[model samples]
Target: MSAAAPYAALSPDVVLAAVDAAGSWSDGRLLALNSYENRVFQVGLEDGGVVVAKFYRPGRWSDAAIAEEHAFAIELAAAELPMVAPLVIDGQTLLRHEGYRYALYPRRGGRAPSLESRDQLEWLGRLLARIHAVGSRERFVARTTLDRATMIQAPMRAALGSDLLPAHLFDAYRHAAGRVDDAVAQRFEAVGPVRQLRLHGDCHPGNVLWTDAGPHFVDLDDARTGPAVQDLWMLAGDEPMMDALLEGYGQFRDFDPGELALIPALRAMRQVHYAGWIAERWHDPAFPAAFPFAAEARWWEQHIADLHEIADDLF
Candidate 1:
């Protein structure tokens, strides 16, 4: 696992000062919190209450991205949608400290639910529908939806046309890229209107929290306006995964043939990206259970094979 450098330095004084400057907390004690890509700390105040401070990784994201997410969360909440709203500090939703932008949030209660319950799956679908409903009102970001070619081509392109991926992946990427148009077009026509809504770009099971109220969504860092199918695509699985979710989601929203058509390819894209990321981070002990090494490697292998088989049919 290649983790980035830790934030400049984390301490109670630094955290308290940041929160105090925000006017939300007068005086608070800070406790270090755990995070994968960002720095999190639990700030305890004189009144014995706590707030979570999330500081973004310096090189990982830009200030604009952070602010957009914070604003989007408030928008969602105002629209009666599920989101982790961020606290304003120093006249900015994101606080700049130690060369990193941060946000403070009152900790909410929730846990990941076991997949055994149908109701839970239904809740996931309904909550996702509500997220889509509110996000579509405005253009949150440009080019929210990513076509298959862009996924396979962009990184390679950035690598200066010098395929840095392993040999095995080269073939898979090439195969997918060659016929990207047909697959994307098929999906667009089937799914209808591209279903572009401001979306939680990474709304997998792990991002969802089964709170006392219902399924309360957290982790809006990857939130963006994009194809709504992208959310369902990330939840791809055998019958248990799709059956209830599709049924439940349908109750809140309907998908045209175009959106439905893109489901499979989009699902494949999600799995491909996830598998690649997990494979890269396989050595990290903290990589979530969902991306366990053995299972992920197996999935990646199968995905490569699937890519090979689907190559000709994509177009």
Candidate 2:
């Protein structure tokens, strides 16, 4: 294992031991879940049941932040939402064992939701509105907010400071990033003030699962405070899609039409932040292997061009 993958220490033994310490009898059956930021697993119990254990990335979140995530899930679950909440053992949802902090959840299974279906999209919209209703009830004191400083400026600084960008293309990349930043700021100003509430933070389709009963939200790891549109825009591919979503969303919560304008700005911010995220994690073996495109000079050139294109669109 590469020294960069800190999860190298999270061997099967450690995983099972953590579950065992949490009062579950591991049947020695373990299946690794698909996750890069955190190490998650499905552990079989002696009673022929399975539970999912998520071992948080070390140093990524403080205990308070993690607790807040747990609290949010629990709150959503209490509202009868289809969100998966961590199981409380010994009066605590978060468990620590062998120098790792983890949480266990009851196994909930569903396939990815079909965003192409109108009914599905509307259903999702209603669900999201309901989630936002619950989310708005409280604010996250420990979590970060989605804003230009955290999303654009910080990412730009990190990218320019990192050696990931090719030396030859550094100036081009910097210039394009600066243009994109200016455009994003102008776009936000034009959109004017919008309501900021507790949001799903990362509400892409992959985070949602669907079954006959409807959709279930998983993974509150990226939960934070942001505009309601932040959760809605990722699901929409075009104007018609947004219409369908908003049509359903109106049934539950009133959405500000002004938020639509922020989509382009949000997209640009995500683009920059994504690159910075990959660069920041380049030291990790998983990142390099998974994002091989980031290592290529041509990719950086294309990325710079894409940034310029987004800037033009925003303006």
Candidate 3:
């Protein structure tokens, strides 16, 4: 078994046992949830109620960092923002059982928001503005910051160091990555003095759920300190969508138009980081099964070409 199969020992019996130990009565029902980085389950209680149990990936985050994530979710919920906070068991949101850290959340469900709709985009913008308002009120001392070093350079190094990139394509990948790095730095320098605040670091559409009431955000697992634009850009796919989002966002808080310049740079960083992330986790069994595309030399060729295009945009 590979080192990445840390959860191999975590069977359905163990999931039910862990939930039971956490003071929730389980009737031996467990359904695995779709997650790659961590193990999550929809556990059914004896009373017919269901709650989501999330087992944090071993060694991915420190206890302090997880606590910060939980705190941020709670803070957002307290402010009446549509965020799902963890269920507190015995006055603590985080719980440990048999050396595994876990948390339980009341199950909430909604469909993906239609970003194509201007009204929906504006509504999402308002919610994000409110979330950012609370995020600005404090700092995450233990969490990471989304910056060039962490998001770009670190991932680039991981990719360059890894054996996953075919030896023949390594030079091409490195050259394109270098250009991307240089361009990203120049863009950031151009957008000088952007404000940094705690944010839903991975605020893409998958993290949001929409219903008749409104949109609710889930999974603060990637929450960290960064420019507010990090939360907004992922939701806006085009110019009109961005304009609509900003229009609603401006209603709650003042937005700096300068941050708009960071979009291309941010997009480039995400592309590089995503590839690196998959490479870093390839040792894990789930990655290979889920991202079979990464195994192809042709994929790397296209990826390098895409990076070059991002560099062009940045230039």
lDDT of each: 0.63, 0.91, 0.91
Worst 10 residues of 2 by lDDT: 1-10
lDDT tens digits, residue span 51-161, model 1: 888877555456666667877889888888767798765567877655556788988767876566778777777777777777777776533346554454443243223
Candidate 3 lDDT over 175-195, as tens digits, reads 999999999999999889898
Task: List residue ranges in candidate 2 displaced over 4 A.
Answer: 1-3
Q: Every model's Cα RMSD, please?
A: 5.0, 1.6, 1.2
| Candidate 3, residue 119: lDDT | 93
**Order of quality (TM-score):** 3, 2, 1
TM value for model 3? 0.97
- Colliding residue pairs in candidate 2: none
lDDT of 3 at 74: 96
Error of 1 at 162 (Å): 9.7
Clash number for each model:
11, 0, 0
Compared with the true structure, the alpha-carbon lDDT of candidate 1 equals: 0.63
User: Candidate 3 — what's its lDDT?
Assistant: 0.91
- As a whole number from 0 to 100, the lDDT of residue 177 in candidate 1 is 42
Which segments of candidate 1 are over 4 A away from where they belong? 1-17, 20-34, 142-144, 156-193, 240-243, 275-315
